[model samples]
Target chain A: MDTTVVNTGAEEKTWGGGNKPLNASYGKMMMWFFIVSDALTFSGFLAAYGFSRFKFIDYWPIADEVFTHVPFVHGNYPMIYVAFMTFILIMSSVTMVLAVDAGHHMNKAKVTLYMFLTIIGGLIFVGSQAWEWATFIKGDFGAVETRGGNILQFVDAEGKRVALSDFVVAGEHERVEHESKNGLWFVDEGTLPTYTMQEVITGFESHPDLAIRTQTINEQGHKTVLSREESIKQLKANGIGIVEGANLRHNEYGTPLFADFFFFITGFHGFHVFSGVVINIIIFFNVILGTYERRGSYEMVEKVGLYWHFVDLVWVFVFTFFYLV
Target chain B: MAHAHKLEILRGLIKFKSNTQKIWGVLILLSIITAVEVVLGIYKPESLMAHVLGMKALNWIFIILTIVKAYYITWDFMHMRDEKASLRRMVVWTAIFLIAYLLFILLQEGDYIESVYSSGFVKKDF
Candidate 1:
């Protein structure tokens, strides 16, 4: 006797049971949900940032002052560079939307082109973030100097802040002596960077004229507008290194927290964009080879389109919070 | 899962548009809104720039406009609006609840931390 077997798929069991109005696959719907959850996660991080801002309202670093440096420009520039980055990501989202449109029309070439542009846009945004990070970590106005071999900062005389460099002078670069390679105890054995924290300290000591400004001081503490006697006294004090977490406040270049979140969240998102690009390339090849035309539809593009747009949607919020707000 | 494939998906760009003109119209409107937001952010007009309800005014506007854009991206661009109400509800409602919960908890916690800070709980000077 012969038996007949039924191959009814999960779709039969109401992965979306009947009475479902829109038709979408389990995966696409799930993608949307994942994006929603992820969006909340990002918002959580940002909200925490805002809360932190309120706590540190007085000494919070000015965004414009901190982020004034621009590539290829000798002097300072405001948020122009990052603003351009925001535009790039948004435009890329538009292109992704258009790619999804092309997918709907069965226009593979247009989809591939738009997808490539989106990938390029993502790469540029990531690069901009990297540049911002480097500028931040290196810090403008340089590090401050302190009497206790620590660096410090404060609000300047003009009611604006200034770096310790405003008070101190950097010593000439000098190498510290260590035991010879053949006789030294193994101390990680790695080569040292040209400048060590110790070298920075020595530089501070040599420049005694640098004033000691506590991180607790306001912007009114750093300017040369003081009375002649006070200016000379400020000139006579030693400089200190910048305080810990000075690199992490809401400051001249926007908030360092802004940089931090922009990097972390956008980095995570960029990873998605990078991964999406790789997947799009794979899909592009299949489309080019007429795989979908033979199989009969281009729903894959639409599915990915949702992910692309979600990334863009998240960026809009990130951009607003970090740059605008 | 088969529908998950790009080849199997539908091109939704303007499939439901009453006309091509309407599609362009929506696109332009979205663009204008974005421009307004960007400009407002840069200039920080007094009317909309001050803090509202304790939060920064710019922040409020950004959050509101961002939510609006998210809605359009979902409903219009992604065509989630055309989806079954159950499906739409699952996505939209869950996000609404989750986001609301997240914002409330984090903001409150943040404020608590700020209060602690103001109370001199965490010493700034080393």
Candidate 2:
């Protein structure tokens, strides 16, 4: 006996395979899912940073004041360099889009060129960020950290920030940092600061033009500037040690938490950028190798383009929250 | 897959001949927005500093502009516009809802902490 199968097309439609539910390729869909999760992770970090800023609302360091350095010229041009960095990243996103368009058009030469431009843009951004981190670590105007963990910065009569090296008188005393190789078997202290507390105190006392500025913001939205007498008194009463730059434990800018968050968020973004550069480099060579051309589609270029664009998108938010805000 | 050549960026008010042109248009828009943001941040006009709904008007502007930039980057650069509606909803909606919920909870907690500190529960000065 021969069995007859039902010709119901409806059942076949219900169990159909190879149909993209989102109308996206498998790789593109997976990339979107990854982006969503990665976005959430970044949001969590940024929201936590917001929480800390709110906690010390009035005492938060001013972004313009903290990030005022340019590569070579640095005469208090606020937010200029960061603005340039943002522009560069956004331009890189443009190049990535162009590369995707070129891929769609099956123009191998254009794709290679655009991808090369994108890689260059990423390199410049990462290098600039590294320079920024270095400048932040080597603070311009040194401050004295209070015993209570607050920072007291120095200013001149006109309320301009004054460098510690400007007035700090070096003493004949030699400072030593403990190393593992040094006599102590288990005690290894970090590198010592350039200037000592005694030197700062002595220098501050002699410089009548210098005053102290607290981390607290005044009604005018600037750091509070104290009178000369109050400056000396406050420093003498609360100053415990000299803090020249930012670290995980100490921040000459303000609360150490700000520095901690800054390092973690920006460092994480930098790592993302680094990986994006590496991925772009790999894909660049692939485009030159005509791998995708032989495959008859340039979907791989589009996929990596999505990733590159996501990195730019994240940087936009990071720039807003960290620098502009 | 057949990709559309023309992109109606502003509901057909502005149209692009090709995808490359559309990308350039979006880039210009993004750059202009960034420039405006930078200028506002640097100057911080006093009138814009007036508190509106507990936040400065300037800050509100910055946040809104940033969202606009993010939207365009995701939609255009990432080609969310060309994707199927279902795919777009799945990716965009999930992120929107999750991020909103997370921000609400975190920001509320942060406001509470701010109130606690400002109300003198714990002296910050040591």
Candidate 3:
């Protein structure tokens, strides 16, 4: 009968709970733990990217030059679209927080609406990322790859970039298509670049105002621009072929590793956003069904909110590391 | 500790009436920081381009602003501000220490490789 006596101590009361650890729900605590591990994984990728960037410090591609294109626009607008993407993601994170707040208030309708907006934002971000990938793969100004595996770009006397189509003159040459009927059926030519090395060289020889821009970043943090004489000499001596856009083996931007890291990092992040959208849709339906209303708490929304916010946080770093720096 | 929320951000400089208001406040802060970053990146002022610790001064600004944004997103949007101290420390400290260590090792190796290319026998251009 005396066992009902008052008892209070840190050790006895601390580990007594089965669900709440440190006063946080088990799900929330687990989500935070998972996020820490995932953050390390992302940082590892980004750090390796940094290592490669530093290794090729002088010859690394200028991110502004590479990511200049905006969707449905023809002119050169550097970093504008990526900036828009970042804003959209941040807005989504805001909406996600709103949903979680509404959950705390037990407002099912508000939570549903905010969740819908967050889903829309996620979709837009994923789509924008896809468009960016396509634009990067289909490059702006084509460049020539040297025998030493270097990228050599073309520029006008004013230092504006010149596309291959602007200068490469077409020559009349009868060529057989590399079809399965002509060549080995098992292996066919993997599409040819618009212009050959000879055509580019010949075009360079004709254009007096054109010069070559090496991938090497000069003292002013711009690509090194060579004179007409040096351009012609370099092209004739080392130019092997033309690289139209980015691929695993070659990239018109600069080093192939640049394209490689860009693809891997952004692709991974896009995949996360894609899955986040899918999860949001599921949670949206659950909220519409009033599942949490019956359970008397909206802890599920809080859990997913953690994930969405984590995605946004990672993008903040990615945006800084890749685009700005 | 029991009933009231620990959600007020900015070290109590600007306390929010509700979590929704706090979310909007964070959004505005993040947007302003992003705007500053984009402007600095686009203009790349000559003074900010001066090298500092093997990186541009402007770049250092970007990284710092990025960390600030990350903090707001975590503390406010993710509700980490309301989290218990143990949980917060467990997540934040682990990430910070590990990422710092990783960056140190990887960057040092990268510098070594660069030295090899410049002063050592290895040549980059064939």
Candidate 4:
């Protein structure tokens, strides 16, 4: 059929370094493409979070109250702590960009300096997040009496969240006890707590002075809150631990859905920050080793730079929704 | 489009001043806004407590401001606005569809859960 055709270089190879469509290196282009996909993934997770939040609109637990712990401080502080964490992540991103600039100019010392700062910033941010998570898991004074398996909290005489034990006199009934796992749930030796829930209920029934009043219910039929005296009396009368999710009733905090979304969205974003830090470290090492300088291209640093910036980008959204909204 | 004065813009953006200045400025602004939001979240301002449009006024403010800030970070700080229109459209369309879908489904399900909660268990007491 005589279908043989001779190559004449008529159309140049549209890729490779010369005569390229974008005129950028493969590595940089790949990084950009990856960033686009990653951004979408994050957005999806965040949007899902938003949907759940909007669904539980009226009764979502307050974020500030829930996240009220800071590192190196013991007392109850509000969202001030997380606000600080957000700033740290954003600052680290700036440092990463500067390090990339240094790499572009073949300044190893400057690159190292900026990279070290960025790493420190990332570490601090991660540590802070861990501390916040620990506080959340342990929980504060749980709900003493719950309307919907949700916790009910009250301020004590000192206007502080008081444990159920604090109000009751010491020599009441025994507290809850658990058997050891060694035995079919071990009856391993341990002291039982004072004042069982039944005992507290009986105490309240017998003692008018110790009549309990819940945050939900007051002396009157109206939903009036109690004073410290009434609060103590109520706890003394009907001793019980904070709401501990007896059976799917709503707790003091918003729906369990709120907590679920909190862990998922923030957990995902934290993972991104963790990986972003690792990637930056790899780029930092390469810059120090003169990898890009030898190849006459610092695009490696730039690629990592884009990833770092994206992490910051995602955090801005996370901070807004999780912390503010 | 080619940069007619790219070098000038880059140089004029800052001289002796470092990039840290811009970073700090934006960061401080963000922090201030956060502080304001935190205050609102904690106190649940009485004015906001008064029901408006079937929700607390504070919630309305928080959601609105949060979206605005997110736009700034995405468009300006992240330089998404500087990208090709196709890239921007790809991101915008995906976000619009996915976010709206998620909201619709989850919210419907959540409201259903709330109904189950209110009706099934805690009804007699109230």
| Docking quality band of candidate 3, CAPRI definitions | medium
The order by descending DockQ is 2, 3, 1, 4
Worst 10 residues of 2 chain B by lDDT: B1-10
Per-model TM-score of chain B: 0.76, 0.93, 0.91, 0.68
lDDT of 4: 0.61
Expressed as tens digits, the lDDT of each residue in B1-126 for candidate 2 is 367644967678888887888999999999999999999999999999888998889999999999999999988999988887888899889999998898888888888898998899888765
DockQ for model 2 equals 0.80
A98-146: candidate 1 lDDT, tens digit per residue: 7776666777788778878877887787677777777776666544434
* Per-model tally of clashing residue pairs: 50, 0, 0, 19
Off by over 4 Å in 4: A1-58, A145-148, A156-160, A169-195, A198-255, B1-25, B42-45, B48-57, B75-77, B112-126
Worst 10 contiguous positions by lDDT, candidate 1 chain A: A217-226
For B12-115, candidate 4 gives per-residue lDDT tens digits of 55322443354445455556666677678666666675557765577788777666656545553444544556666765676667666766676677667657
Q: By how many angstroms RMSD does model 1 differ from the true structure?
A: 6.5
Best to worst by lDDT, what's the order?
2, 3, 4, 1
- lDDT tens digits, residue span B1-126, model 3: 122456567788988886677778888889999999999888889999888987889989999999999988888888777778988898899899999999999999998898788785876664
What TM value does model 4 have? 0.72
Question: Superposing all C-alpha atoms, what RMSD in Å does each candidate have to the true structure?
Answer: 6.5, 4.0, 4.2, 6.8
Candidate 1 is graded, for docking, as acceptable
Q: Using Cα atoms with residue i matched to residue i, what is each candidate's TM-score against the true structure? A: 0.74, 0.94, 0.94, 0.72
DockQ of predictions, in order shown: 0.36, 0.80, 0.68, 0.35
Model 2: which docking level applies?
A: medium
